[model samples]
Each structure stands twice: as C-alpha cells, then as structure tokens.
Target: MTRETVGIAMNGVTGRMGYRQHLLRSILAIRDQGGLALPDGRTVWPEPILVGRNAEKIEALATRHGLDKWTTSLDEALADPSVTVYFDAQVTQARVPAITRAIEAGKHIYTEKPTAETLDDAISLARIADAAGIKHGVVQDKLFLPGLLKLKRLVDSSFFGRILSVRGEFGYWVFEGDWQPAQRPSWNYRAEDGGGIILDMFPHWRYVLDHIIAPVRSVYAEARTDIPTRWDEQGREYKATADDAAYALFELEGGIVASLNSSWTTRVNREELVEFQIDGTHGSAVAGLRNCKAQHRAATPKPVWNPDIPATEDFLAQWQEVPDNAVMDNGFKVQWEMFLAHLVADAPYSHDLWAGARGVQLAELGAQSWREGRKVAVPELDRTGK
Candidate 1:
C-alpha cells in the first residue's frame, strides 16, 4: 500500500523537547524506520522541516537529522503550500500566537500541553482552530506510558473493583541553579513567562483523572513558591513569583476522592518522579513511571499498627510486580507517532484541542481554588466546534 507523506512544519525545534523528542525521536526516527505502520496495511511517513530562530542551530539540527529543510522564519514556513501540519513546542507564553497564526494559515495543529497560561486564551485558540476546520491535538504523553497502560487495563478489567480513591505523588528537587545548572529552561521558573507547577502539570492530571480514573467535579488546592529565587543558565538570579508546589484534592463525579501533590521542591526517595496509587474495595494497584504492582483480594495482607514491633512482612510481600507487557518508547515519541497516524490514517485521537482547553481550564480553576480557599467546579467544553 502507498504511504502518505504528511508535511510537518515544526516550530521551536531548537528547544530541548523539540530537538530530542519531536524531531529526532518521533519524526526522524519514524522516517528512519520506514515510516509508521497502520492497522490497515499502510504506512504514514512524516516530512518534517525544522523551524527555529537560530540559523546555526537550525542548520545543526538539520545536519544531525540528515534533512536540508530548516527555517528561521515561521511566516515563511506557514506560507509554504506543502506544509499541511504545524507543530509547536515553543515556550508556553509564545505558543498561542504561533498556533493562532498556524490556524489562520489553514494548517492542522499539534502542540505541547498547557496550551496557554490562561483558560480564556486556551478557549479562544480552540475556537479559532475549530473555525479554521483544522485537526488539532495536544501532547498528553502520560496516557501512553507503559505503566499507566497496565493500570488502565486493570481498571478496565475490574481488577480494581469499585475504586475508592487515588493518590498521586509527583516531585523531584530542582537545583538552585548555583551548584548545578537548572535542567529546565529559565522561562519555566518565571511567572511572567507563564510558568508554575499548577499551570504546567494540573492540565496533565486533569486529563489523566478524567480519562483514566474519574471525571473531576471540583478541586480544592493550596500552592506555594518553595524556592523563591533561582539562578538561570546565564548565572543570573531571578525571583520566582510562581508556585513551585501544589497540593490538590479532587472530588470526582462518582464521589471518588483523589489527591495530587506536585512539587519541584521535594527530594526524590520513592520509586519514580510520578507515582499513582489506586485503592479499591476488591484490590489495589500502585503504578510508577516504569513499573506497576498489584494486590488482589486473595493476596491482600492484614496489618495492625504496633509502635514497638518491626514492620510486618505481610504487607511488604503482598505487592506483586506486574510484568512488563509492551516495549516502551519515549512518552513524547508515542504521542507524536499517534498524532501522525491520526493525520494520515484518519485514526481517532483523544488529545484534541478541547482536551487541551480542558486542561487549561483545570489549571485556571486550580489557581482560583487556591486563591479563594474554596472548591472550584470544572466545566466541560463544547467540543462540537460551535
């Protein structure tokens, strides 16, 4: 069968995620592997053009990927008739303008999550993309993680019958940029640049909870800027006006309670940077980024609290490590391949702009909950392009 080569104009290719995940890992790797195979005995290949501000960086990325198409001008790339899709991995503050322009150019759009800093902007962008009649998607990479997939299986199979509650522990201590350079970009730490843990990650949790666990009816949150100041890559200290940590409690539609704690200040001592523990009436499962462990009713262990005694082995040994079921790719890469497949094969993609907008709405409401010291109800979007 003939493969459809979709022309993808990639903006913000010089950034860390853009360079590694979208360009080298997903697009170029797929092209290198003879394109992505579809279920219907066809393949979808991507023809990607790197777009960035730095000429040297663009050339270097192009050379590294063995591609001659590279551009510093977004306008030039948008004007090109061959580019049917526009992908943005730009900074949070810069994303709306570029994506808005892309929609105006009649290009299908895909971009990184936390679509905008504000809910209104996210909704507006969704409206614009729908009006343009273009396919749109946001990167919700966690849905494709192997561990999470296993958890989804258990949920679907009723292994966790009548889920009682969920606990999400996510954090890693970020360096102060003095002893070691910060891993993330400088803009990520600045509030003016649309940076904050609530804004950045709540969107992710929203989708994960809504799609996997339960639809959140309302949220109550408290936030803090644990690290008030940090040095940048250029050795300049900047005051952080945004919160570095967020503790939130969610009330789901079915009276299921979930708690999510996201922070940049906590030291990592657990299984992974992100871990989800789901407890049900029949059984329980704990999933980390790389692995999952389950305890069925039959295998469940009884325990009693005793201050004078050592911890019992019953609970310790009850968890059985779930076998790895599928070979895993980088989380971002999986979503990228899926997006390409959605475009070329007309496959159904769940992480559309409406989903993205919902994420933004969650973040916005989370902030409101924090400020008002009250629970904020989440509203569903109108996905009919109305």
Candidate 2:
C-alpha cells in the first residue's frame, strides 16, 4: 500500500476550538486511525506542525500529545514548502492577514467560520484565494452531525414531502462570571474582539439551512445583549458590547420558512443544546445534536382540544426515535478526513472559501435586518455589483 505525507500548518492551535476540536479530536484522531484510506488502496497521512504565538504552550501541548513539532513563527511555518496546507482556527479578526500570507505562499487553506468579521473581508479572502488558484475550505461541521445527517436522509427520502417550515432552538444558559464562572470565553461577549452571537453562529445556520433545508433567500432578525454585564477569566468585570441572543426568521427557496433562536442566556429545555423541528405535509422530524425523532401524518393521533381536562395523551411517545443505520464519526474529524482525501485524491469537494464568505454574508445581513427592523434579501455572492 502506498502512503503519502502532507504537512499541515495548524495555526491558532492554542485557542479552545483550535486545540480541542480541530487539533486533538480531528487531526490527531485522523493520524491515530492509520491515516485516511483512499479508493485506490493508498493512504494519506497528515503531518501537522502546531503553529501559535506562544512556543512554550504549544511545545507543552505537543509533548502532551507526544508530537515532534511546534513553532511560534507562522511565517517560518508558511515558508516551509513541505507544509502544503494552512488551517486557521484563529479569532475572526486575525483571519484575513494570516490567510492572505498563507495563500500567497501557495498553500491550501481551511478555516473556522465568519471567515472574517465582515462580509467584505470574507469575500476579499475568497477572491484572493480564487485568484491564487489554491484549494480552499471552510469549517461547516454541523452538516456532518449525526442528527442532521439523519434529518438530511429524511429530507432526501421524501419522508417530509414538500417541507413546510422549520423551527430551530439553539442555546444554553451560560453561567454568569459572578456566582459561577462563565463556561464560554469572555471574548465571546466583547464586540471589539469580533465576538457576537450573530457573527459566531449565524454562519453555521446559513450553511446548515442552505445544505439541509433549503437555500436561504432572505432573513429578518432581532439581536440583543441579553446579559448586560459579566466577569472575565481574571475575575474582571466587563460590559458585553455584542449581542448575546438572536431571534431570526428566514425564507427559503421552496417557500419554506424557518424560525431560529440563538442565545447564550437561555436555558436548554430540549433534548440537546441545539435542536431543529422540521414540519411538512407528510411527516415531521425533530433533530438534536446526535439523535432524531420523527412523526408521520399516518401515525398522527386524534385528540380533543380539551385543556380543561387533565392532559392524558403521551405526547413524548408519539415521535419515534430514528436509529443510526451506520456508524457515526466525530463531525469535525469526518470533515478533516474528507478534506485530506480531496487534497490527495483530487476528490469532489464543494464547501470552499466562497461558501465561507456566504456564511459571513448571511451574518452581515442578519445584523442589518436587526438594525433596520426589516427583512434583508440575500443575493448571490457576485463580488461585482451587477
């Protein structure tokens, strides 16, 4: 069997999402599993060189994982011809400059969402990468989730014939830094840091809705800083300048409407931290992070509208749990494997830097809708104002 090694310059490996999900869980896990197998009896192995601003921390992290390489200089890492790919998991604001340098260095690029804090910057990066003729990708892990995968299957199978509407509930009560420490980083609440619920999550929603449900053509949203004040990691009191919650309405291509509530201040009263209920004429399904439940029109029960009498119907038992017919892998890891396969085998991969820019576009429109208190049209990304 033939094996090929591709060096990956993993930038911002020190950040929480970078370290935990992208680094340890996805990349390392792929390397541990004997590399990604190709269709032609070959295997592709990723040689990740951890890149960050702090040498000691990355070195310690490398040592803890028993890896050989770690570096503080991104320029040096990019300068290495061996490093064929540059993966960015840095803060939103840092993406443009870093990715610009990497693209100029002739490296394939993959990165976390919002590609940039604004639509213009995101489109600029996408255009630059396109002009440079480099392969590019954006992280859209939610599409690969088990629940969403099952939901997609249901959609594909026509189980939900002529889908009508979708309701999405995504959020959990993040502890305030006073009595209990905030679970999320303090930078998440500060607007100056390119941190806001809309910027952070609307990207995910855009991709998910476009891929799974339907193409989003318009959006009307309301954003708020639900929590006025919070404490930082160092027990420092700070004002939250960014929006913590977003109530959104979206219109899809097939006349499907979607309602979404994203917040860090609300309590989770559902199956998972994130869930979506899709309703249609023939059937309906509710999908959580890892599980999905469905109820068809044939299985619909008859009930009287008698709330005066005690509630007797077992509403929870009405929906049947969808079983996993195939083994499910970590969402992030799955995407990484696909990306590596694309790099080595020249496989068909559609989720690219332009897709990432669309995410940023949706977010900007969502914010605009909130500001103007009106629905905003989502035009196709034509950098030229045609």
Candidate 3:
C-alpha cells in the first residue's frame, strides 16, 4: 500500500558480474519494476549509490543508467547517514577491508562470494557481522536457477527415490588475449591477485551440494594450470600462475558421492555450460541452467555393450523434459529480492555470512586436499569460531 526508498551503496559495479548481474539485472531491474513487494503489502524501493575505483567508469555507468549519487571514496559513501545497506561485488582480494568498513559503519552487508580468499578472514567477517547485530547475505545465485529449482522440487517430492550419486560438468574455453581477447579479466589467472578455478568455483559447489543434495563431508581434488601462459587485455603476455582447471570428488553426508570437473580451458560440448546429473536407485535426472530431463527406472534404456556394433538407440531422446511450472526470474535478481526482504521484513535468510564462511572453508579445504594428495575432512564451522 505504501512505498519507501532504501539507500544501497553498491561498490565495484564496473566489473562484468557486478555490472551485468547486480546493477543491471537485479538492482536497476527492481527499481524499474516499481520496487520489491513485501508480504505486508508494502513496497521497498532501492536507491543505489554507485561506488568504485575509476571515476570515469562509475560516472559513465551512473549517467548511462540515469542515476546521480556516486563516489569513488568508500569513506564518503559510508559516512552518508541515509545509506543503510552496503553491497560489495568487488574483486576477492579487496572484499575483506571494504566489508569490514561497512560492518563498522553499521550498514547491512550483502556481498559476492568467496567472501574472502581464506577461511579465517571469511569467518572473522561473519563473527564481526554477528557482533554488530546486522543482517548480511552472500550471493548464492545458482540455487535459484530454473533447473535447480526443479531439481530441488523433485528432491522434495521424492522423485529420485534413494539418491545415489551426482556428477557435474562445468566450464567453457576462455580465449587467450593473443588471438582473441580473453572473455574474463586477467586477474583471474594470477594467484597473487586472488585468481584460480578452485577458489572461484569450489565455494559454488559447496552451497549447491549442501542445499540440493547433501552436506559436503570430505573433498579430494587435483588442481592444474592447463595453459601456463596467456596474454592480457592489453595484449601483454604473462605467466598464468593460478590453476585453470580442477577435478574433484566430494563425499556428502548421506554417503552420496559427487564428482565434478571445473575448467576454463575446455570447450563446451554439453547442453549448457554447466550441468549436473544425479543418479538414484529408482530414477535419474540431468539439470542444466534452465532445463532439466529425467528418466524413471522403468523407462531407462538397457543396451548391451558390444565393441563391434554401432548403437541404434537414440539414448538422448529417452529422457523426458521437465516442465517449467512457473515463471523463473534471473538467479541473481531472485537472491537480491530475497536479501532485501530478509533485511527489511525480517524474513528468514539462510545464505548469511556464516554460510559464506562455509564456502570459503570448502575452497580452502579443496586446495589443501590437492596439495596434500589426500581426502581432506570438512569440519563444521560456526560463528563462534568453534
């Protein structure tokens, strides 16, 4: 019935993910759509103050989007009494100090993950947020995807019967700047600059498996730098020190095993850039970004293996397509909406700083597992540092 504006200081929106997903698809989208509606029939409008390092880029972005409030200094943004929320989509290395300042300023925190490069830093943030009595959230966008939503529904409805295992494939070939300008930033390949496929992706896998399938108990991983050298955006050659690829096996709580491959050097051959196939005793399902397909035990094809004969069965067609029962919003937008509600309406939110710490924990453990050449146990972590 009534509408009110909430000031949100958005930092690091000049980057690709911050610009395309958070600023364009989420925050601005919500503004354009007449704000987010709460359960009590009230509308919560978002007024974003653009904050970044480059003045030209931030100003240009603000002007292009028809926005006015922007500043390069984090202190100036935090000093604004009207700014109640601080959202960070900054580079991984810069997140801690920025978020720490926001927490000290008494602003509710929302950030992109891996919350910090190390588990300790991430946990420290969580503790600090809790002590400050502020609501906080981390981006776990993939859990809200159409396909994953459908998979979650199936899991809830017992569609799979007894779950057995999960196999996931994620990645696409990133061009070297020499021939074609690389799609991703140059910092992604530099370990000193918080770059690596393991640190980048293991956090995502942590939440996905924990929420969708089961809690991750152990991890065994092998990380590699497939392309040791690549050119940067300026066409300057540099040694790629961070891992470009990682092959991993995770042991979940219910004895369910998940094996996943993450790579930036591999070309896409699957239906989507990322896909997860789950097998159970009674049925199996495959889910991509927006679509899912399933095969019941009774309908599964049985073909005898023969070395000499060509296969006649159209195996791909056997699985039935899962329908989109409802309209699905962009994953990033969905999470943004949820976080806003949680902040304003005191709605239950699970993807908090603690959850973010868990993601960082997984990534840290995954790296340790790779280094030690053993299955590393994932101990439970909480806000108390116990």
**Candidates' TM-scores?**
0.97, 0.98, 0.99
Q: lDDT tens digits, residues 1-386, model 3?
A: 99867899999999999999999999999998999999899999999999999999999999999998999999999999889899999989999999999999999999999999998899899999999999999999999999999888888889899999999999999997898999999999999999999999999999999999999999999999999999998899999999999999999998999999999999999999999999999889999999999999999999899879888889999999989999999999999999999988888899999999999999999999999999999998866865
Pairs clashing within candidate 3: none
Measured on C-alpha atoms, candidate 1 has an lDDT of 0.88
**Shift in Å, residue 56, candidate 1:** 1.5
Summarize candidate 1's per-residue lDDT along 1-386 as a digit string, tens digits.
87887889999888988888888888888888899899988888889988989899899989976887889999999999989999999989999999999999999999998898887889899988888888899999888888898888899989989999999999898888988988888777788988899999999999899888889889999999988889988999999888899999999878899999999999987878999999999999999887889999998777778989888675656799888767888788788888877887778887888899899888989999999999998866776523
lDDT winner: 3
* Off by more than 4 A, model 1: 384-386
> Model 1, clash count?
0
Alpha carbon lDDT of each predicted model: 0.88, 0.92, 0.95
Instruction: Give candidates' CA RMSD values in order.
Output: 1.5, 1.2, 0.7
Tell how far residue 97 is off in model 2, in angstroms: 0.9
Model 2 Cα lDDT, one tens digit per residue, 1-386: 99989899999888899999999999899889998899998999899999998888999999998988789999999998889999999888788999999999999998988799988788888888888988888999999999999999999999998899999999999887998999998989999999999999999999999999899999999999989999999999999999999999999998999999999989888879999999999999999989999999999888889979998999989999999999999999999988888888889898888888889999999999999999999998764411
Instruction: After the best TM-score superposition of candidate 2, give how far the Cα of residue 228 lies from its true spot, in angstroms.
Output: 1.3
- Model 2, position 247: C-alpha lDDT score: 96
